[model samples]
Target: MTDTVADLIARSNRLGADPKNTNYAGGNTSAKGTATDPVTGQEVELLWVKGSGGDLGTLTGSGLAVLRLDRVRALTEVYPGLEQEDAMVAAFDYCLHGKGGAAPSIDTAMHGLVDAAHVDHLHPDAGIALATAADGEALTRDIFGDTVVWVPWRRPGFQLGLDIAAIKAAHPDAIGCILGGHGITAWGDTSAESEQRSLHIIDTAAAWIAEHSRPEPFGPPLPGYGALPPDERRARAAALAPTLRSLASHDRAVVGHFTDSDVVLDFLASSEHPRLAALGTSCPDHFLRTKVKPLVLDLPADAPLEEAAARLQELHAAYREDYQAYYDRHATPDSPAIRGADPLVVLVPGVGMFSYGKDKQTARVAGEFYVNAINVMRGAEGLSTYAPIDEAEKFRIEYWALEEAKLQRMPAPKPLATRIALVTGAASGIGKAIATRLAAEGACVVIADLDADKARAAAAELGSTDVAVGLAADVTDEAAVQAAVDACVLAFGGLDLVVNNAGLSLSKSLLDTTVADWDLQHAVMAKGSFLVSRAAAKVLIAQQLGGDVVYISSKNSVFAGPNNIAYSATKADQAHQVRLLAAELGEHGVKVNGINPDGVVRGSGIFAGGWGAKRAAVYGVPESELGAYYAQRTLLKREVLPEHVANAVFVLCSADLSHTTGLHVPVDAGVAAAFLR
Candidate 1:
């Protein structure tokens, strides 16, 4: 890449990475440069702008759309009026010289039409504060004098780009302008100059707001609205997430994220929160993620837990009704259908914010955007009044055809998408494989294991915290088991699937088995499975969302294998627990099942923990041939691996077995003796 293009990427990263500058996937950056045309071997002036759906912080050369500047600018000749501006987006594809790098965004016109080497259109909270102020035009002049101008509100399209170009051409010394009720746009002769100007504008605006702002932008905290103690608040948040998730998923199932950050707590406590929140967010990017407004749980910090939950239900129902009304008020004959009635954001006075989306990252980003909106509210309230774009205007952008197309273009979700699972003893072997597979199928997973570090490492291997989180828990201990369940709720809202995979084996003959050996095997496999299931059941039951619980039993549960008294007994205990729990939990829409796999020695924790040698010795086979010996005995004569068991778990928990419960699926490569009768 040329230095100019590289600099633009670096500058975009610098600005986009910071939440103060722009939200995830919001805003665009551009660089104008010369590139040798492969067709003509002639130098051509091209515009490299951040592509549609690309985040500035992680932008790459490949994420930028390359267009001939001459063709881009020539569109002004056939520029339709504001009503027909959307048509211009399609016209951009015709401007591409040779193979374009990425799809062009609507903001392309704003960067291409402007006469500058580098341009930045950012949605910095501080700059947007001035942009969304009631008297934004007047505030712009007062804040930056004539160096920065103000342009009236116009929907982002060719018309807005033309308006900005006109403003820049008319004012020779102007460095940038606040796009009224939207964001700020700046340009410079060089890449460094443009970045410097953008930062200066944002920082200067923030300083001005801080200097001339009210002592309490959100107004003083109301009585009983202060944040609860950290432990209490988080505990409350964890307890409340499942129900909130249930309410939000009325239209479709969604993963959730919870935050008790100072900003969220402070906003919830403010006297002005109700009114300002009702007015909703100003930025299109902000509202698109957060929705028009958040659903506030109108209860104090000390309210009874049951009372608080009841109030949340009422609040959610009311929010849905109001949202439907809002959609009805503005939807035209050709407008996109109402996407969902459930609010994306939920606010609790003493707790924090709960944001839900199709996945964890999207939910987390939605919460981040709401925080940005709160900052904008603080600044706008200090300047004049927090005047966001009107309801009609917001509805227009929310239901825009282009946005609908973007949603439609999203890839199909995986089979386990939106499901949250917890796998016990998932640090390695079969448990880890199960967690990895679950995450790959789009379910957020918690790697719960006695080995804390390995659990964390296993979670990391899956992906970011949004996809998997690791926690330490000894299922034999009730408190530790409960803590693990709470942590899972705190991490990704709630649990939908539970895998009782934590176990150890002791292959001792009946005469040789000690009391300690019997207790150890039974405690880890049987008792531990019971504890995990009971704790996770509370959350799933509270969610009122049907869930799955799978027990990783053994082929020995059914098969009578000699010299394995303690291990075989414990596996049999686990197998029965699955049937018992399935019968009991079925009333609550919870499915319980089991996977019986034989001689999974390759990656079996059981085999690795001295059981392999003991069992191999009893069978008169070398340890290296134990798997093959077991495989040869089975009808299929195939060695069952950890992944085979993981696949069985996935199938049991997936929608494919929605109607089948209390069933034992064997992963022992056809152990007919171990098969359910």
Candidate 2:
């Protein structure tokens, strides 16, 4: 990369990496420099601006759009009015220097039309506080004096760019200007100067708010609105997350995120929270993620849990109705169809906030945006009456065709997208394979195993927290099982699929078997499956979203292998539980299924635990050839691998098998003795 572009990237990263400077993927940055034109062999001025949907902190040269400066400036001659501004984005393609680096964002015109070598546009909380204040224009004058100007509210497009360019021309000495009811844009002749000015502006505004603003901005907490103790607050959040996720998924399924941070609790408990939340966020970027407003539950923190849950259901219904009315109020004949009537952010006094999205990252970011909104509200309220963009303007931005087109550009989701799964004993062996497969198919997985470190390592291989998390759980202990289930709920919302894969084996004749052997095998396989299923069932049923329960029973469950009384009986128990639960949970749309795999010697924890030697002796073969010996007996004569069984779990839980529940899929290389019949 050229030094100019490299410097611009460093500047962008420094500004964007800090939440105090900008929210995730919220702002854009640009640098103007000369580059050799490949065809003409002449140096030409070009604009390198952050591309559409690119995060500034992680921006690279590939994530920037390069356009000929002359072509960009020429657009002003053919500039359409505000009504036709969106068309300008298409025009940017014609301005490309060559093949172009990335797709130009809507803010491209703002960066290109400006008269500067370096520019930064950010949504710093303090700056937005002044931008959204009721007396914002005057506040800008009082705080920034003539060094910064105030531009009236204008939706981002070619018009806003032209407006900023005009202001810069009028005030040559001014370093930047606060874009009214939006964010702050600063520019300078050099990259360092531009970054410095941006920080100075943001820091100055923050200092002003801190020094001059009135105290008790959020007002005192109401009677009974004090935050619940940390433990109770978290437990309450976990209990309510499933129901809230269900409500949020009324239109479509969504993953959820919960947070009871000090800031959120303080905001929710304050007397002024209801009014401020109802007025909604002012910044377009903030509202786009958080929604126009949050659904605030009008209940105390210490209320009865049962009452709180029932009230949440009632409040959720009202939230949807209100959202529908809002859509009706502003939708035009040409407006995009209503996306959904569900709120992205939900607020409960004393408890915390719940945010939902198609996946975990989106949900977590939505909550983060709301916290940014809360900071903006605090600043604006402290200085003057908190004011945001007009409701009509917010609607216009929320339903903008450009925004809809952006959504359309996103890749289609994977098969198990938005599905959350919990896999027991997933640190290694078949369980880990199942977890890996599920994560690859787009489900956020919880790798639960007795070995905590290995479970964590296995989960780490899957991906970030958005994809998988690991925890310790001994299925024999009911509390540990419940905690594992609850941890899944806390990590990525609620559970949609549970894989009961934790198992052990003992190959002893009935006469040789002791009570300890029978009980040990039964505890881990039979009672373990029961404990895990029961714990996860409460969450799935509470979510009211249909789910899947897959048991990794053995072929021995039905094959009646000799000298394996304890292991065989437990597998039988697991096999029967699948059938029985299928009958009981069909009304709730829960599918229960089993995968019966034999000769899975390689990578098999059971075999590695000495069961292979015992089984090899029983079959009168060397332990080294146990897998082949078992495979030779099958009709297909194929060795069963962990991946094969994982594939079976995927198919059983996949939409293709939505109607094929209460079934056993045998992944034992066509062993006729273990066939479903």
The estimated TM-scores of all candidates read 0.99, 0.99
TM-score of 2: 0.99
Query: Per-residue lDDT for 147-189 in model 1, tens only?
Result: 9999988889898889999999999999999998889999999
| lDDT of predicted model 1 | 0.92
Task: In angstroms, give how far residue 30 of model 1 lies from its true place.
Answer: 0.5
* lDDT of each residue in 1-677, candidate 2, tens digit only: 99999999999999999999999999999999998998999999999999999999888889999999999999999987887888999999999978889999999999999999999999999999999999999999999999999999999999999999999999999999999889999999999999999999999999999999998899987889878898888888888889888989999999988888988999988899999999999888888988999988899988888898899889888988998898999999999999998889999888889998999999999999999999999999999989998899999999999999999989999999999999999999999999999999999999999999999999999998889999999999999998898889988889999999999888999999999999999999999999999999999899999999999998988998889999999999999999999999889999999989986899988899999999999999999999999889999989998999999999998999999788988888888878887
Model 1, residue 292: distance off in Å is 0.6
Residue 514 in model 2: shift from native, Å?
Answer: 1.7
Question: Which residue window of length 10 is worst by lDDT in model 1?
Answer: 668-677
Cα RMSD, each candidate = 1.1, 1.1
